[model samples]
Every structure is written in structure tokens, then in C-alpha cells.
Target chain A: MMTAQIKEFPGVGLRESDFEQRKVLYTEWVPNARYAWDAGVAIGRYLAELKEGRLIGVRCRHCRRTVIPPRVFCEWCFRPMDEWVPLPDTGTVNTFSLCYVTWDMRRLTEPEIPAVIDIDGTHPPVGILHLLGEVEPQAVQIGMRVQAVWKPPEERTGSILDIRYFRPVREG
Target chain B: MTRKVAIVGIGYTGCRPLTAEVSYKELVYEAAVKAYEDAGLDPRRDVDSFVTVAEDFIEGTSIFDEYTPDQLGGMLKPNVTIPGEGIHGLATAYLQIASGLVDVVVVEAHSKASNVLTLPHITAYAMDPVYNRPLQANPIFIAGMEMNRYMWATGATQEQCAQVVVKNKRCALYNPTAAYGANLEIDDVLAAEMVAYPLGRQEISPHADGAVVLVLAAGEVAESLTDLPIWIRGIGWCNDAPSLETRGWGRAIYAEGAGKMAYQMAGIRNPMEEIDFAELDDTYAYKELQHLEALGFCQFGEAGILTAEGVTEPGGALPVNVSGGNLGCGHLLDAAGLRAVVEVVLQLRGEAGSHQLPDVETGLAFGWRGLPSTSGAVVILSN
Candidate 1:
């Protein structure tokens, strides 16, 4: 047995009835604030390119790697990226998950497929996280070929969602 | 000679699934009072400063620090808040003492996860708004992807991952402070529903409500105050890539870098032979294996074999997380690391009772800030 025992500190869990009774005693307020974040220079350009129905990346000359979800500055080299490069819509699934719950904590009957897709023409494994569509969950595998399914040109927004989702690439 | 900071006193309260009777401030006060009593010092006089750890989104309050000091008895004394884990706050306190800025300092952190109605939303909010958040997927999906990549890269089977849940959850059965202790077999774990592929519902830790307070003093002050001082032998923390795409998928480079710096400070050349045991972050079962490789406990992709051999079980060669880890003890968020610290202190002082290990002279602890974030911390304690 331990020589010195710290007494257990207990907490009273308020029951539903207790909450109802204490409603008059407590104060409640909902937060009301809206935000409009700027996508900034690199992401701003990336979104604009998506609006144009093209995939793009920035090349860090020093590291000689074309990075997607493009950044103006190279995180590794600490230098400005040299040039903009066009990337192919097709890529490989680096990894993926079958999600049964929604972001707001809702249970879903149809699972959401989220995956990291390594886009072509970018450096190896330079991927973007997005959803997988037009494929069964059991069919998804690491290294599976996939291609972006863009929103219609008229419906395109300058946001990442402009790429509807990725689908399994059909072979010739 | 460089000054050494030691943890002279510790206190904790409410390691349960929910704690509605007392508000978070009251919870902090309970721990602070007990810590002060144990150290035989008055926070009003003896303590020179205070540090509290918390995240704003989780608290649903901006500037959560505004509500911290009064309950900590830190009313007027220099008190600051770290926007990181509990052990990070301790690291700040350690720096304060080592810098000769103050002699005695107190660190506090607490969790009221039950109050969080939209945890997945808050987790998604932590992601990159431009690249990751718009997908609107559950944040656990990232852990699933990482787990899949880790298994594919290292050949670590799901069976090995399930075994971690079995070992840690059963370890909690002997821990009086653990809230989620259970008698779990690997088969039981394997049969659990998969939340994300490779990670079962049982493999993830449930959120817990708790608070931990620690009193740290300079070496001389510590020796004068308490005979059972757990010396901070080494401490380190690091961050990998802020973006998940660029970071290493199979291993935790952050924990590796942090553990390296800590080991260098402690003059430990070999962790496996020199360190007695560890209490690593096991928020997700696969994380325990990933962190083991990162912490240099074993070679790359070798934690599974060691675990299978019962080397990390209590009464085994390396007794990792005899207090049940986060898997059995519940995830305390920012307070998670300090909970590990509290357990290490108990084991070192031989006060762990039923879960006590024999002659535990030194211990190591690891804490991760959770998914969509690669931040982590490491601390070593010696009696």
C-alpha cells in the first residue's frame, strides 16, 4: 500500500433536471462573429488558377522541387519560389481514410473518403488533402491512380472546393 | 555550475469523464491548494510566478488566461499562459528558474472536454483553412491516413496496434486515478468498430476532465522544502512541418528531435538501457508505436516486436505507461503531458501503490498536441 494517499476529489455532475432548475440562475450567450480571411499571395494565385480550370504549383529553384498548394516562399530554402508551373490533374493516392462521421459530429450513413493525392508534375509526394468520389470505399488503395473532377467552368469559385473531388483515373 | 530546477510538490483533481459540480477555475484551485500544502509553502509568499496552459477554441473563451490566476492563488504575482501543452508550460517555468529570474514557480493546466459540443469542428478549425479545412472531413481521418502510411511503410500489422490497446487499458486496472481502466484483450480491441481504417473506436482515448498543478523550485530551495524532489534531468520539444503533406508520414520527427536534445542534456547516450520506463502519448493506439520509434526506444519500425514480446508491459523489461497512458487514463488535452508527469513523479517516489514498479529512479514522458499539429514535448525526471 502507498504510504501517503491523496484523497479523491469528487465533482458533482449536474443532471438534466438540475440544468433545467438552474436555468434561471445562470447566464448564457452565443458568440456572434464573422470572418473573411484573405487567401494571401500564393494561395490566392492557386485559387485563381483553379478558377481557370488548371492545376498549378510554385517551383523552389534552390531545392529544385515544385510544391503544390503553392507558397510564395520556400519553407526549406527560406527563399522566394522562382516560377509558376502547371501540374497535371491526375495523381496517385498517397494515403486515404473512410470517414463515418462529419466534421460537426454527425454520424453519416454514407462514409466520406478523404485522401492525400500526390499531383503529377509536382515534386514526389507533394500532395494535397481532398475528398475521393465516384469510387467505392473498398476500391480505394494507397498508390491508386486518381484525377481531379473540376466543377463546371460557370460554377467554379476561386476556392479549393472548385475541384469537386478526385475520382479513379480510367485507363486507355 | 548550472542551476537545476526540481519538482518539489504536485497535486491533481478530477480524473473523470465529466466534472460538472465545479467550474474549471474551482478545479484549478483544488489542485493548487493541495500542491501548496504538499510543498509546505504559501503561494501568496513563496511562489514567485505562475504558468497555465490552455487553448482558446476549446474553452470557447478568448483570453482564457484572464480567468486563471485567482484560483491558482497567483492573484498579483507574475502569471502567464502558454498556448501549448502542460509540459510546455513546465518547460517555460524550468527556463525561468534556470535563468535565475525566480526561485519558486507554479505550473497549472486543466481540461473540461465534456463542455465541448463540437470537438471535431474545433479540430477542423485548427487545420489550414485554404488547403485542409474546406474538405469538411472529420479530423480523425488524418490519423487514419497516417496510420495507414505507417503500417504500409513499416509492415506493422493492425494486430500489433490492437495489442497496444490491450496492454495500456489493462495496465489502468491497477491505477486508482485512471478513469477508463478495463480488462481488454487484443481480440476485443480488434473486434471494435473502426472509426477510421486502422484505428478502432476502442483504440482512441476518451476525453477526460482533470487538472494538475506542480510546484518547481531551484535546487537549494527544493532540498530545503522537500526530501522527495524529482529533479528535471532533461526537457525538449520540437515541431515538424506545419503542413501535413511535407512531414514524415511513418515516424514522428518532432519527438525524435525533442528526445535527442533532452537526452543530450541528461548525458544519456542510450535511452533503452539507461532510462527506466516511459509514459508516452497514446491518444491513438498507432501513435504509441510511432512515438516509440521516434523517441529512440527501439530501431525504426521495431516497437511492434518489442511490444509483442511483452517488453513494454508492467512487470516486463520496460514497463511503459503503467498508469494506463491516455488510452486508459483518458485524454486531458493540454493537461495530458502533466498527467504523465504526475504519474512519473508517483512512480519515482514509490507512491504509485498498486501500480508501483520497483526501484524506479528515472523516467521519461512524451506528449503530443494531437492531430493537424505536429508539436510535441519531452521531459525526464529523476529522484
Candidate 2:
């Protein structure tokens, strides 16, 4: 677990008089958990397929195109996706950003760059978002070749985080 | 092309950092009920159509539109959702009424950011999953980059940026519903913890929970329903080129295009003079200044100095964000845009009370869909 040091603004002219100094307030307010049934079920099915070490893509029968991050329907044709096919994980980098921070607005000791890898083997390039580990931020170029780093079976969750990250694949 | 649309009724819940008493559904109902009562009509029967503004990622739920109808009393009607800013949703409703397809439309926008467990994680979902999120940079980093470029290109200083917060927070002191009201000084803003380089925590709009609803109808219907109907003279919306690397970082191209389209439609050539006041999306202090420059209120990089000159204050040449804007008032996502419209309506109807500006006849409300990409809306309102 990562923790950040909290810093507060010091007294400055008017603000010193207007607000209470050295005060912090935290409240626990939670909303009712409500899920959209159809969208929930669709994502559930997609996760189930990922656990078996097989990449799945939802195929739009009408357009004969496969969509990654599996959608219930094709955006263009407005037709239901009837077939699911295995996809190749190898892909090229389309675009990337080098992040030097963490999730909670805290600066990370070591920076990491997250990239959107477009898998090469599928038509229209099945793109999956994941971290780019063991790669220097400056060396990350558009269209760079990369492959997935799968987690051990015991550590896999039915979630996108199951893939630890994608690393560069050396050419022979 | 046929019917002229006017806003007959409007209602807004108070902006707060957190509303612990109510659920998201209950908050929506409160605003919708107030709007219905103000219009003197039944939400079930009188409302012919419904439009809601929300994004699946922001709300932490997918297909969020599915559960919204029950709260707004639009159980089964011609209802649709726009997964963008609230002003874009309003523009869609306005066009529907103008086409004579719908006689009356009810638009609702709400936000419960307090409920989200991790806001940064939710914001990460908005990035182009393949490339942008991999950077692991928080969304505020983008604001930092934008501010850095704006200063580099226009020669604005960090002090000028800090001054915007000082002025707006002071203006908010007079606004009863403003959540972050303070008698802040530039030094206070500068001394505050820095979230991103050149962008302090005070410069950003605080996350908030609230809702806003508006009832719009054709001119004939509005005239018969209320004595003071705020006319929608023109509406325009546009999106910028998505890639941050390629787009102009210093200037708001999206806002410029939308403002021009709206001003052209409203037949107003000189916006700085003709317009009484304006409500701009001030999610960040720099954004307020950046948008003002883009709206042709001032030249690029001049907005920071113009704001420091008190030009945007209540008694200044053009009072901007009289309702305290998103900075003073807490930011409520989709509701932020409609809240601006509500303020304009209140001012036009002589109902803004203490925060009201002088001789307000026509006002412009601008909304920007922040971060990852730029999307914006500009609407002209007249009494």
C-alpha cells in the first residue's frame, strides 16, 4: 500500500482570518449500490472467458468485425454480437503517455507510462489498455511492438488487471 | 425552424462538497419536483419529452440512463440520454422543440462525486485506454500541461493565475450557496498545496454533489405558462480534435468555434459590449481565463491580466460567473452547465437577489467538457 504525506496551506493575509487553521474534515457517505443489469451481465461473461487463458472478442455478425472489450452490440450496425472468437494478444503500440504520478494525485517515486496497445493479429486492431512495464518513458514510440505479460493462474482476477502489463518483445 | 423555444421554469439544489442526507435518485427528484412546481405543471402529464446528461464512467455505473427515468418521473416517455456535458443535452432538447417534434422538454443534470470511492480511477477510465492511461498521470497533470503552455505561449505568470482564485472566492463570499466561499488572497492561493506544477489545489473546482433541472417549451406554450420566460436566442456546441499533442493547448478552439456559432445565430457581433454578463465554465482558475480569451472577451494571454483588473467582477465591464461559478460553488459534473443556465435565468427574471448584476438583458452561458479532450457549448439567453 502507498501513502502520501498531507500538506496544508499556511496562513496568508485574508485566508488566515476567514477559515479555521489546521483543520481537516472527513466524512463517510456512501450511496446505494445499483447496477445496470444488462451491462453488468455482459461484462461478467467477458471476464469469465479471460480466466481460461484465452482472449475473447465479441464478433458483430452483420459487419463481420470483432470488437475487443466486448460490447453487447455493434456501434455501427446496431446489431447484436452473436459470436465470440479467440484473439491474439500480440500488438503494436498506437499511442502512449508517460505518467510520473499515482492514482490519488501523489507523485510516485518511480514513474510509469501507460500505453494503448493495438493487437496486430486482429482485424481493425483489438486495442486493450494496460501498463507498459520495463520500458523507458522516452523510448516509448507510437507503433512500438509489444506483447502481454499474463499473471499466474492463482493471482488472476476476472478483471482487466489480470494482465500485469505489456512489455516489449525482442526481435530475432 | 418553426417554433421558438423559451425556458419556462428552472430549479437548482444547493452546491455542497457532500450531501449526506440524500441519495442520487432523491437529489434528482428534489430538483425535478421544484422545477415542476415552478412551471405549475404535472411532470407525469405535461412533460412531453425528457433528456438527461451523464457519462457512464463519471457516475461509476454503466448505462446510467436506465435508472434515471424513475427519479425524474419520466417512467415511459420520449426519453434519451447524452453521454456528455449538460449543455450539449440542452442543445439537443432545444433543437427538438424548434423542429416542432416536441412541444415541451424537461432536461435534468446531476452529480454525486462524493459517492465515488476513487475519483482518479474513475477519471482514468475516460482516457484512451491503450495510450493515455498508461502514463499513470493523474488528470490534473493535463491541466498543469495546459497551464504551462498557456503561460509559455501567452506570457502569463503564476501570480495572475492565483489572482483568479482570489477574486472568484471573494465573489463567492457574497453567494449564500457557494460551498468554497472565502476571503482568499493571492498569497493564500500561492501558498496552498500544489496538486500539479503551476496548478495549485485552490485553482481547481472542488468535487461536489447537486442537481439542476429546466423546463423548456415552445414560445406559445411558454407565454401562456409564465409571465417571465427566458428566451433561448441561440445554441451551439462543438468538440475539438481529440489528440492533446496535436491540438492548440494555449487557446480553447472548441469554445471559440461554439461561441462564434452561437453569436452568429443570435445576431450579436460585439459580445464584449452587447452581452450584459456571462457565465463561463471555471472548473479551473486558468480555464476561466482561458475560456474568456477564447470567447473573444479579451485577447489570448490577456485574460489573466483582465481578471486581475476586476474586469470580470460584478461592477466591472463584464461580470463573469456571478453565481460564483464552478470555482466558488462546488463542481457537480453534468449539472455544472445547467447551473450556469439557471443563474442566467434567475438574473434575467430579476430573481438573482443579492448576486444579481446591473441591467442584465442578454447573457451567455458557456460549458466545457474538461480533461482527456475538449467539448464545449455556448447558449445565448434573452428576456
TM-score of each: 0.69, 0.69
Best by DockQ: 2
For all candidates listed, what's the TM-score of chain B alone? 0.99, 0.98
DockQ of 2: 0.01
What is the C-alpha DockQ of each candidate?
A: 0.01, 0.01
lDDT tens readout by residue for model 2, B1-383: 56899999887887888776666766776788789889877777788998999987666667988867766768777889888788998998999999999889999999888877677766655666555656767887888999999889888888888877887778777777778888888899999999988899999999778899899999999999999999999789888887766778988899999988988889888889889899999898888888998988888888888888889888999999888888888788888889889989999999888887877899999998877668999899999
- Model 2 chain A: weakest 10-residue lDDT segment is A31-40
Q: Candidate 2 chain B — worst ten consecutive residues by lDDT sum?
A: B124-133
* Per-residue lDDT over B1-383 for candidate 1, one digit per residue giving the tens place of the 0 to 100 score: 66899999899884788776556765676788789888999887789999999988888778988877767778777999888978899999999998999999999999888778777777877877667766768889999999999999888889899889999999988888899999988889999998999889998999998899999999999999999999999999999998977988888899999999899999998898888989999999989999999999899889988888899999887888889999999999999999999999999999999999998899999999998889899999999
> Local distance difference test, per candidate?
0.87, 0.82
Q: Candidate 1 lDDT, tens digit per residue, A1-172? A: 4535746646766678877788534544233223223344666778899999998899987888998978665545434579999899999999999999999989998899999999988875689999999999999999999999999999998878999999999988
